[model samples]
Target chain A: MTNTTHLIRDARILGGERADILLRGGRIEAIGPGLAADGAQVVDAAGAVALPGLVDLHTHLREPGREDAETVATGSRSAAMGGYTAVFAMANTDPVADTAGVVEQVWRLGREAGHCDVHPVGAVTRGLGGEHLAELGAMADSAAGVRVFSDDGMCVSDALLMRRALEYVKAFDGVVAQHAQEPRLTEGAQMNEGVVSDRLGLAGWPAVAEEAVIARDCLLAEHVGSRLHICHVSTKGSVQIIRWAKSRGCDVTAEVTPHHLLLTDDLAESYDPIYKVNPPLRTAEDVEALREGLADGTIDVVATDHAPHPSEAKETEWCHAAMGMLGLETALSVVQHTMVDTGLLDWAGVARRMSETPARIGRLTGQGRPLAVGEPANVTLYDTSAERVVDAAAMASKSMNSPFNGMTLPGRVAATFLRGVPTVLDGKIQ
Target chain B: MRHLLSAGDLTLDEATLVLDTAKELAQVGGRSVKKLPTLRGRTVVNLFYEDSTRTRISFEAAAKRMSADVINFSAKGSSVSKGESLKDTALTLQAMGADGVVIRHSASGAAHRLAEWVDGAVVNAGDGTHEHPTQALLDAYTIRERMGRLDGLRVAVVGDIRHSRVARSNVLLLNTLGAEVTLVAPPTLLPVSVRTWPCSVSYDLDEVLPKSDVVMMLRVQAERMNAAFFPTAREYSRRYGLDGDRFARMPDHAIVMHPGPMIRGMEISAEVADSPRSTIVEQVANGVSVRMAVLYLLLSGSGSGTGN
Candidate 1:
């Protein structure tokens, strides 16, 4: 492995002035123009784009009980394929990833998977029921060194619970990733509550249900003066609230998934289970607002709330099917399509949203570095101009549940390196 | 291998194949092992974006019995609540290597869209009120098991006709099976174009009851009540509810039915639901068989006409 390691040239190093990057002993040993290529196995990088390994703050590995959906190994492989070097695994698995033991189980599995650095996010409340706080210190002290905490599947609905979780994580400098949606307001909500709901005759999942929670959580974050990370921030109001919070200098950060940027509630008219998302796809205005947030940095990171389901659950009636789509395989391409191809933002923003900022938010220090010397060899090489249609059959995961099938994508991840090892090369998992 | 996304696309022969295969699956469902290797290596995802107890658990039990790896994905508990789009979740499921997806959504065409997006087969559980094709299949299965045939039998679907997916599907299916379909409901309960239906409309339930072979009642969704669709539940039930009086009015061979979780006295009297001529509980049991058939035929086997 050491003898086969080498250097790259003509790469657009994100955030780095130098175009050359040298890798030796799992870190960039040198990065400069016209560096010697002697005794090195060289990988040509003429006209290819390089980004710091991406980071995801919200992802469900579904281990402990639902490992069949995704274990750390499979999920890490997905992250690698999506050009992610680190991801904060959500805490809503069967056992909830609430306790130190469960979080440790997740940590060990990520280590065993070895495709990416899986940061275990301990639950804010035991079982994520929003009733009681979990042992934050114990999880942070565990081998995984959990730094990001969340009640992802469930919001810490109790105001006191949210406050307590925020203050508690302060001990470990942990950021509380909140899944915003008021518990009582959202029960039996099958679709986004508005014109679509009235038209479809299904119960409405009101946007206010999410926006209200974001508003409440922002206030709580401000009150406690503790860092808060909003997971999968949807809609214009939530973005506005987050923007206000950040302007007030409150320690609040937000993420918007790739789908929110590209799709909207019009698809709901189809009454298709494939478009039945949680915070159900909002209006086109919301999509535009999310795009603007992603472009101008109102949204801090682009995370794949990568959730997988068996085909049976997803195949049922619209009101009975699950509400998620697999995202890791197409996150970059989507960000590139909706943000870059449209020319709203440049490669620097792509690197920030996909790579650098997520690492900072999740506290993954070894990741999100410019491709250069003496930096941990975490890099994603891509062809910014490639065009290909996405097919679930060709993807690496066991599930073929992607919504991008047959849709042409203009961006592609060509190679990814994790600790100086090529986990992916030529668009194939190595 | 999983995810029943739509009813419109399935051929009649294909629909019957699922019904027949479900009959085979029912025999083995209660065996000591209570499992099969049919879907052992396969992964089935239960992706319900809406609130569902019968449909969700039915699919859950069906997949588990087939020995497929099952992942229960509840939207209430995922990032879906935040702002993650359905497509993102689909990509995530694809990345997890889901071989099959059983989905129920609130939207009308969600399942069809899913079929377009993924590699697995699509099964339309129900998309909006446009169709609940499987419910029709199951109801037909129950009718076939009891009435011996579908040709030329009179079946009256009563109450909340406009709001009931079950009614719409049953009407289409029963007429296809050669049954004389009559939709009995107040003018308010009928769709905007009830006149377009091949079936007859009866405002007089008592008049329609004596002539019918199957008096199927639809659950009156209370949520739709605010629209003044009907005068009141009491009035609606008095006119359309199946009680001993209505049961006695029907021909001796006529059976009563409802696609269930019946509102009890609201849809039918307790006695009628439990009557010899009533097939409500049998509907629940047949649901498994009907669903098993849908899964079996959709996943691997031929359509229902083949004896096998």
Candidate 2:
């Protein structure tokens, strides 16, 4: 709905040759050297990388139930700040986004916020009970058009039920995103099972628990001839399984979270709940495998899984603490550090993994499009040379549970244009 | 010596100092004047989240013998039962100006978490299946008393090593003291990563028993049977339990110890438990002296100045 003409000058188009991008209405009007402004607002992006606005395949915008943690409006603002033009909202909310009404309501909230596009993910189970199937057809047919179905925080552990959900989603060209975990193997799991868990006396969440379920689901997806998306693949064993499944040509896509790529289970030595998370932070070797997997395109996207929790939920004993950390505001910086700074991926590769592939996985066409003329002007200006210490309190999200708090991270989102409208300008919300 | 949260935190020298100090304090147990004024004005709080009459009273007696004011905060009658968090309870204890906080909780790392919230010295009484440094100290003191030396001594710790905090603390502390220790338990009753521990592990107690100078039996909770850690108590007892015939395999000078509230005829025979070689009763008495040494060394400025 924006008509503001903007002339973004001397920005490296996907870290390539410098060009002037003229955004008119909601599409790119022109892209060339020294383009005329014609009374348009001029932004000096002389040293920034201009790529497609980022898209997250996984995000928990806790609304309609746990508004105390994060709402759609605040989560959308946080997303805009993170250079994300769109995010897939997880369905594990209070009322549970199982029906069409909840999905439509969540979609409406994102529209009203005007910061970013929020695609509501429908629950695969009725209440994520892992027993009966939810009304997946109704959710996909609703105004929200939920294409991704998941029982994210809780896994659909029942094998027969998982097969049915994977098969049912094929009616709408939908992809079933599974939070892969074998429930019994991970019962009373506190952190990663290893020498560390053995030393600390915390219950171990073994890698086989996640790998077993992922292996089963990949086979199910291949047998049913349906597309399956694995959410937040954490273990190195999981990467090998997905890579093996791809060799057999299973229509499966996988994502790795920002924290999983950087943090490891050794942080649990402090017994601080801030380090506590689901599929809990793994080993350094696993981190290397994940980075390698993402670089090789074995892992298609870098989903935020930007789960936020209230302070009370995280400030207690490790076992009593909640299971996620804030990721929307820190996702790109972590990727820049763990991927680009390591010389494993260039800026163009980043656009593919963080934006293009994620959008393709979510079936999002408006997002992940190239920054060429006549395309939707979803652009992000990133200052790759910049660095700042992450301050949890300064984040746009309602919760102050960022695990990266006080850690210096590279890259800053200088500006974000969502459909020609400046959602973020000069690193501040418009 | 700011916090005795884990037995692994102790060095050889620090553990020796505690044992030497406890030996001196053990003399006070035989004297008519059993009280020491070293910690006269200090306040010690026993903040127990789990019901452990034995551990709580041992800590209370230790603090009282040193003339420190003791306050027992059991979770049953407190605001903790009404949903007060551990951090909130820690802050409350902090407000009361506790010089040392002795905590026993059902959650592992609860003591470590409390250490972050309070400035006072923290002593872990027992935390989940994690560690009980004081219990290990007393067990170590009793072994040293009977064996005359810890170096080159063979020790076998049998039963539920997975859930026994005593076994974890003893393995770490005893290994630090230069004792060659072996853990004897069923594969399911032992942690999978026990190979990484400083001590050796075994499944057969009889094989480990004859080579031991000290045989310590850990209590196998009856509830562990329902969880199928073992098929039945009889099956576990037949394989790993200590009885007369098993005890006969130990060296003549070797001692039998249990961190008590014994599950009679299950993990140990009543006859062996009451045998002259058994130090079960003396371990309880030695617990007071060892805890007194820990408190004095951690709280008194002079003792802590040179301590770990």
* Best-matching candidate per TM-score: 2
Best prediction by lDDT: 2
- Look at candidate 2 and give me any clashing residue pairs: B1-B308
Off by over 4 Å in 2: A1-3, B302-308
User: Which 10 consecutive positions of candidate 2 chain A have the poorest summed lDDT?
Assistant: A1-10
For residue A82, give model 2's deviation from the true position in Å.
Answer: 0.7
> Which parts of model 1 are misplaced by more than 4 Å?
A2-4, A15-18, A269-272, B1-308
lDDT of 1 by residue, A198-229 (tens): 44556667778888988888888898889988
Every prediction: chain A TM-score: 0.96, 0.99
Q: What tens-digit string does per-residue lDDT give for candidate 2 at A328-351?
A: 999999999999999999999999
* Residues B1-308 of candidate 2: C-alpha lDDT, one tens digit per residue: 89999999999999999999999988888989889887887889999888899888988988999888899998997899999999999999898888899999988899999999998999999998889999999999999999899988999999899888899999999999999999999999888889999999998887888899999999999999998899999999999889999989899989999999898999999999999999999999999999999999999973222222
